[model samples]
Structure formats: C-alpha cells, structure tokens
Target: MIEPELTRCVASFHPGATGVTGAAKLSGGASQETWTFDIVHPSGNVGAILRRAPPGYGAAPGRAAGLDAEATLMQLAHDAGLPSPKVMHVLTPEDGLGRGFIMARVEGETIARKILRDEEFAKARPMLARQLGRVIAGIHGLPQAKLPQLRSLTATKEIEDLAREYQSFNWPRPVFELALRWLRDHDPGPSSEVTLVHGDFRHGNLIIGPDGVRAVLDWELAHTGDPMEDIGWICVNSWRFGEIDKPVGGFGTREDLFAGYAEAGRKVDPDRVMFWEVMGTLRWGVMCCGMMQRFRLGPDHSMERAMIGRRASETEIDLLRLLAPRGK
Candidate 1:
C-alpha cells in the first residue's frame, strides 16, 4: 500500500493534480523500494519515481544515512554540470516515505547486461569511452566549497581503518580475505586529497543513448576521497561486462581510456589505476558479504543478493592473479 504521506507529497509536488497512480518497481535496486507513478495534473500528465528506505534496513549498525545524502549529492552533481538526473524533490524520513528523492526521469538504457549485448551501442563504443572520461573528469573536479553539507559524510578514514572494517565483516569467502590482505600490503601512503569519489562507477551504472551517456545513476555509494577511486572503479574486471579481454567497461583498452583522459588534460598514471582496481575488487567483495548478511537481518528473498555474495570468488581470483601471476 502507498503511504498517505507519499501520496500527499507527490500531489503537493504537482499542484492542481487530479489523479495519481503508481506503477511497478524498477529492477536492480536492492537497498530500497522504488516505484514509478502516473500523474494527471491540470497542466498535463507526467511520470515520476519514488524511492523509499525499507523497514529495518537503515536501523542496522554501520549502515549510514544513504538515500537522503545520495539525493543531495546527485543534485549537487547536476548543478555542477555533470550529466545526471535533475533533482525534483527530496523527502526526509520525517516526511513519511522513510527517505527518498524524485528527479527528472531521463531516457537511456541502464541495464548492464543489455548495454553489453545491444548492437546499437557497439558501433559507438569508442565515443562512449571518450564521453565517459569527460564525465568522470568533471565529477572529480567538483569544488569542495559547494558541498558543505557533505563534510561529515566525506570524512576520510585511514587505510588501516578501511582494512579493519572490511576484515571485521567476517567474510568467509577465501578470495575476499586474500584481497583484503593484498590491499593492506599495497596500501599507498595515506592520501589526504579528498575529492569526490563515485563509490561505484562502472558501465552498468551509466546509461547510454543515441546522443551519449544520458545519465549517471546510483549515487548511493558516492563519497569524498581519492580521485583514483572512481578511476579504478570504472576499470574493474567485474565491470568488464563479461568481456574480460577489453577493459574499461568492455568499451576499449586502458590505453584508449588513458588517451581520453590525456585529451582532457588530465595526467595519466597507469600504476595508480592498477592500485585502485585492486581496491575496487576488494571493496566490492566486502560489499557482497554485507549483502549476504542481510539474509539474517530480514527478508532475504532476493536471489540476486545471494548471487552477489557468490560473485566474491570471481573478484578474489581476479585480484590474486593480478597481484601474483602463476609463473613469475
């Protein structure tokens, strides 16, 4: 059942509304509930999406206030001229939808599986790579002054703390444990240049259209930290979309991506990218375990969640192979 507060807020947002009808949930979201709605206002009809926190999920320890902050970050990113959803309205937990935001629904294909297989984007792969570099550069270039509300959210943690936090999750997966160790041993000297890091930046999170990447969705994991974090994340093997040979979201080689960056006047560092790729794998592996833990938290009906836990093995194996080749 749709809560009255959500209905009221939706109506209020669209003044002179005559009727509002909600559609089904959008696939691929696990942390929260998302639904599309149809509105019949005096002016015209428009479609909207409503996202809300699930019961008992946010109450868990170590789970930060995500949805509300994500909305703010997305808006800020959009305002900064980064290609993202135009912010509409943000509802607090006090507002009764638990926590959520409504934004302009832009059109593009977001499903990773489809984007990889779709023939239309195959021809524009090179252009996509260049475009991706530009957008990433812009996101990394956001000024700290404009994002004051994110101070507590962007607090940097020591590498030791990050390492300990993942280890404490008690992931039973062997590969995940090994990746954690690799990260600890390879810890780059604590970098304090806190820039905006898109916690998860890969092919799947981006939407492609005839024009270019229409929108960059899913800011739930956005943070303030190393710029290389996003760079490494985009090149992670798991995000290669079943095309292991070609890196950078399976669109082009690392060289191609570096060219795009160089064209944008951003210095290229192969070693930094390699380091972040390792970190990206370890971070994802740990997150997979966290999702598995949710089974014990509440309803764990999602086969996708179970599969994500299983995916830790692939990440671990990839990390190990990268750190230590079979025959040196």
Candidate 2:
C-alpha cells in the first residue's frame, strides 16, 4: 500500500525506475515517525529513511523544531562538510506519504551503554568528545540568514520555562527547588554570541561507528541560542549513563571538549558552560517528571515513559553533586 506511494515519491526525486521494499517503522510516537526502507533500483537497493508526521499531525508541539526546518538544517550541515545525513527528498501532498522528508540512512549505533562498554567502539570512545566538540562548533557556525525561523532562547527564558513546567507537576522536589534558586540568583543574563544550539546533543542523538561520530541526527530540538548551551547539555550526568567520572558523554573530559571547540577558532567561556551544565541537569529532571504526567494523563500509556520517569531521582543525586560538591 505505502510502497506504491513511496515508489512514486522516490521516482520523482531519485532517477530510479522501480519501487520500494522493506518499509518498516523504526520508531515513532503520536507526533512523529521514522521509517526505514530500501528504494529498489536497477543499480542496487538504496537505503533510505523517512521522517514524517503521518499526514495528520500538523506541526511539532511545544518546543520542537518543525520537520521542514530539520531537513534544511541537515542539508546545510551536509553542504558544510559536517557529519549529517544527505536529505534526498522533501515530501509534498502529491507524494501521499504525509509531511516529512526522505534522507539517506547512515549506519551506526546509538545506544549509550553499548557505546560506553562495548569493545567495538573502544577506539571511538576516547576521540568522540573532541570530534563531537568540533562538530558542535560547526553547527553553531552555520550561516544564520540561510536558516529557517527558530525560537531564540536565553538563559533567563530557559530557567523560567523549566521552572514553570516543574511547578505545574506540583511535585515537591527540594533538590529541584535548590537548583531553581541557584539558577535565579546566578542568572548570567544574555549571552554575548547567539548561534544555533542543537538543543538535544547526546549519545542517543549521535550516530557513532568505530571511526567516530558518523552523523548527527535528531534536530527536532534545534534552536538559536547561546552556543554554550549545546556544550552544557552534552555534559549532563544523566547522559553519561554511569561513567560519571568522564563528564563528556562518559568518554572524555571538559578540557578535551573545549580544546576541540577552540580548534574551530571559537572561544569558550568556561563559566557559562558550567552554568548551563547545571541548568541542563535540572531540565532533564523536570522532563522526567513530565514523562510521568504524560504517561499517566496523556494518551500514550507505554511503559518506556514510566521507566524513564523513575530515573528522576538519579538526577537529584547529580544536581546535589553539581551544586553542592563535596571536597574530594
């Protein structure tokens, strides 16, 4: 059924003469879906992925960057010689698949635990921090005028947003309250330079192979903001997934990350990165609570939400370690 539509879609964009096969849903929810398939052609089978809203969801809710913007960002990164998928086609109504785009698939592993412990990625683990640092710099350096309209965020606005979202849950998390007060009292006001911030940059969003980061995926949370925000978010403890000692995604240190960023001719303010790290920690905690609310009250009743929601307490431990560090 969908193959017929996909066949037509690919034929228009790619000079292929045949159809599609092996179309299967990889992951999805109510708002978005990712499907993997092979475009059958006389040359061979070309692996492709479709990220769409399934013909019904009009736009991304809350703070998500719309799919159109995601496609554009990907194309820009690809053009800039950064690690990103090559966008193959942008869907139209006539394509009949929904609102989304097709992109060439990059092969890699996204699981954090496996990337941390597995021998296959052993060589990649150490170099990832620095390599990804350069990648982040490239992302921040993307030409602004060519970019699609995105929400610009500041540290104050981010704190307020997180605070409001947390208070709505009516959950009395003392650690969260402490973090909120600290962020307010030490508010750094506006940043000196605003650039594209990959709002969610972590293990799961990166495609890693033995060589290093093959491609950066999931620009759904991409936005224009303090460039330091991206560095801070990547350093959060929850993303480390147990390798707390290695702060940068459980593989490397802040020093290396900064070094890599500096290699790109960009200066970094260590103090700002530190502040955003704390903010990012508390933000993830609030999001965990939101997951609980969505699971209990929202339409989706999947157990994954409940599982991730239970990890909120771990973030409290991390917050304490960050804000009130003990002499070691």
Q: What lDDT does each candidate get?
A: 0.69, 0.92
lDDT (10s digit) by residue, model 2, range 133-180: 899999999999899989899999999999999999997999999999
Clashes of 1: 0
Q: What is the TM-score of each candidate against the true structure?
A: 0.84, 0.98
Worst 10 residues of 2 by lDDT: 53-62
In candidate 2, the residue pairs with backbone N, CA or C atoms under 3 Å apart (3 or more residues apart, or in different chains) clash, namely none
- Tens-place lDDT digits, model 1, residues 1-328: 6635556776767677666676567752446777777666778767777766754456312434377777877787798888888777887555566666877677778777667777877766767777787778777777776653442222124345556666766645566566667666766654456677776778667878856688887776666767667777788888877888878887767777777766766765677678788877777767677677665564775777777767767777787878776985
Tell me the TM-score of model 1.
0.84
